[model samples]
Target: MTVILLAGGLGSRMYPLTRIVPKPMVPLAGKPILEHIVDYLNTRGFKEIVIAARYLGEQIVRYFSNHPHAKPVLLDSKDTADAVRLLGNYIRDHFIVAMGDVICNADYSEIYGYHLSANPAATIALKQVENPLPYGVVYLDENMDVALFVEKPVSLEAYLLSLAYYRRRSTSAYENLVNAGIYVFNPYVLEVLERNPGLMDFGRHVFPYLVENGFKVKGYVLSHRVYWSDIGRIDTYKSVMWDLLDGKIAGIKPPATEVSPGVYIHPSSDVRGEIRPPVYIGREVRVKEGAVVGPYAVLEDGVVVEEGSRMVESIVWHGTIVGRDSVIYDSIVMNNVKISRETRVYSSIIGTRRIVSGELRNSIMEPVEVVSPYAQSA
Candidate 1:
């Protein structure tokens, strides 16, 4: 089956980092989140993959092309409906389509199986989250069919978010299944998508149409216990990386990137330094000595933690530099960033190329918005 991965979001919440790479390419557990996603799909014998991208779409295409495994396809477009419709038109059979930005350990085998067995126009992978307001919530029927759909309700009450909890919601109200951004679609559904290219999301658009227009759409609540975190924000990115750095979750078995006696780097990396361990680094990276890299932190590849700089509990991404003697703690440095000497950073996301000198105290260094006790960006 072919899988269409939606990787088109601007990743506004994951700026700087997203500024350099698509969210699907974001680092997670010492590997690109997309890699993990692909690995999962590959394990299921699904080799043909399509990534629907917009921002930095070529990067995703390039990264996959260089590395051989599953042959991945990239589509850079603004319309999700058109992407899916095109994909559906190409694959004239039942197929899987998933989110390109999902950061989870969910397995698609069962979800895919139920979809085929039920033979519906579409089969949605769902979960009911405690706070259903921020997600595409749904209600399921007794026959495991979706009866209602709600896209991100702003309710504070716990909605018990899980594909399983949909047992109650899908049977009771508006959204029967909480969308997990995974779906199985039959070729017959292509006309629906083709007719409605303006639809924002599959859950919000196509599924509702199917339900209202007498289309058979079902829900398969995945019964697996896996760690899934959406790393679309600085906080989430930091948390997911920390879990990998600390061995908190077992998602994809990451490629070996460790070199030094104690350091643990990603397989897709290049480093030239005597680094210490308890560190997590991303793919296609570089590192230099006197850089005192990590005891409990990470350095995403293409990242340059220059001499005399010390990074702890911080995530520095591609094309970034932490200058000499600069101390960074509990911070996230985005791509294309530059940090000067003797600077102190903590608890913030430093945007791309924010010049720094002196000391910074709890700040999100935006584009050219320096935080050091020095002159500002011109």
Candidate 2:
């Protein structure tokens, strides 16, 4: 089957990071999330894959080209709908369209089967989440046919009241499912999209239009316990990373090879520091004496943690040098960064090639050459 991965949007939520690479190209457990997505699709019997990429899309194109797996078609487009439209002749009779940032382990085959059995214009994968306020909720009838769709209700009370207007049970909002950002579409649906050129989005326009026009659109509720995470923002990105470290996200396993209980150190690295459990030290990493790497820390290739430094619940990317006596906690240090001695960092994001030294709490340091206390004071 053909799968269209919508990866075009500039990941504004993940700013400085996306400034370096696209959202899909963001590393999760040392592998680009887009690579993970491709692996997931490949296993599901998807022969042909198409990536809809625009902002910093060249990176994605280069990454896959160099790696050489499915060799997916990279369609440069501004919108998802336009991307689909651009695939004029390539559009198959049945296909899947999914968001690139979503890390979900749903059975695509089952959803495809459900679509074929129900014979609807479209079948959207739905998941039951506790708080559906942030997402577009899908109301399904007894037969699993979508009854009403509410796009991100303001509050729980508002959602309940909206349900009450349609005579649907108030409790339905709590028990109802939300769109999982996964869709199965037929060729006819493309014609509908072509006719409705004004319809920019699938959630805000196409699905609503289909529902209004009495088009049979079904909801496939994922029955099994599946791991699903929308890694859109900084918090969610960290969450996915933590989950990968903890081995929470199914299907995609972390590249952590533990030499001791909860302590993973790459063979190529030289570690002399006291490392606590649940730590990952990548290749060519150097943790000097008197340094404490711990609790939950991930140091990528070429990372150097100097003496007297302490890191906890932090992720240090490639070529970063943690200077002596630096304390990094609950932060993400990107590629080629330098943290000067005695610097204290907490809950911050140090971008690529940055040089930070000072007491920074909840700070976001971009890719600057130097960001020291003296530099800022002067």
Candidate 3:
């Protein structure tokens, strides 16, 4: 079966970072998040992958130009459902549609099998989360069919209604199962889309239409052990990074080699400083003498940590230079950044190609100008 990876959202929540790179292109461990998703799908025996991209999609196209299986399809549609409608030519059979920004260790084969047996028009993947207000809350019937789908019940009345329904069903309030953004659809669903041209988003329009119109839409709940996250916000992005490093996420490996227990360092890196465990140092990374890295740190390829600097619980992306005596804790420094000496970056995000000096805490620093190769070519 073919898989359609949606990578076209504006990603407004991720702001400056998304300005240079799309949400799906954001690096986690060493590869792009989309790459990891593709790898995961490949491992699950799904070789036919189509990435539907827009909003700086050329980068995605260029990235996957040499890839054997994953292909990028640039679309002009403004919404998720529209993107799928535009790609209707590619849907010849039952297909899987997944959000590009979501990463999970979900069993796609199992979901496919369930969909086949249930034989619903669509099977929406569901997962229980602590907070359901930020996602599409799904209420399943006794037969596992979707009874009601509420996309972000932020209103008080909506919350009360959901609470009442859960109470009637004897389900715990905290046990809120949300739409995991993975769907299996029958080809007939495209006919429904053709009839409703204005149906833009699956969450906002498509699923609700099906449920209200008496179409069979089932919910497949993921197992508790399955790890999944949508890297849409800064906090979730950081949390996912930490989870991947801590080995909570399975079936994906860090790009570097584990030199010691919990310490992964690439062979090309030149390390002369003190490195605590639970850290990853990538290719061509240089950790100078007297610097203390880790306890939870990720230095991507070509990064340089100068002498006397301390980086703990931080991620420094490609080609960034941490100046002498600087302290970076709980921060994300994007690619090619240069931090001056004696700088303190705590709980902050430094965007690409920036030059930083002084104390930056609880802030977001974006570059005055972005000189990207994509921009140049465009």
TM-score of each: 0.80, 0.89, 0.94
Looking at model 2, residue 244 earns an lDDT score of 74
lDDT (C-alpha) at residue 242 in model 2: 77
Model 1: runs farther than 4 Å from truth?
66-76, 153-177, 197-200, 257-263, 266-278, 282-296, 302-308, 367-378
- Considering only N, C-alpha and C atoms within 3 Å, which residue pairs clash in candidate 2? 262-278
Write candidate 1's Cα lDDT for 225-327 as tens digits: 6666666677777777766666555545545555554367777676665565678776666666666767767776567766677887777755677777788
Residue 268 error, candidate 1, Å: 10
Residue 68 displacement (Å), model 3: 0.6
Error of 1 at 276 (Å): 7.6
User: For model 2, how does the per-residue alpha-carbon lDDT over 120-152 read when each residue is reduced to its tens digit?
Assistant: 999999898887667777887777778788875
lDDT of 3 at 272: 99
Question: How far is 327's C-alpha from truth in model 2 (Å)?
Answer: 0.9
Best by TM-score: 3
Whole-model lDDT per candidate: 0.68, 0.80, 0.87
**1-378 in candidate 3: lDDT tens per residue?**
889999999889988778788889887887789999999999889999999999888889988887888989999987999999999988899999999999899999999989988889999999998877777678887778888766655586777677667647743332588889999998899999999998999998999999999999988999889999999998888888888888889997788887787788899999999999788898889999999999889898889999999999998878789999999999999888999999999999998888999999899988555543233222
Candidate numbers, best TM-score first, in rank order: 3, 2, 1
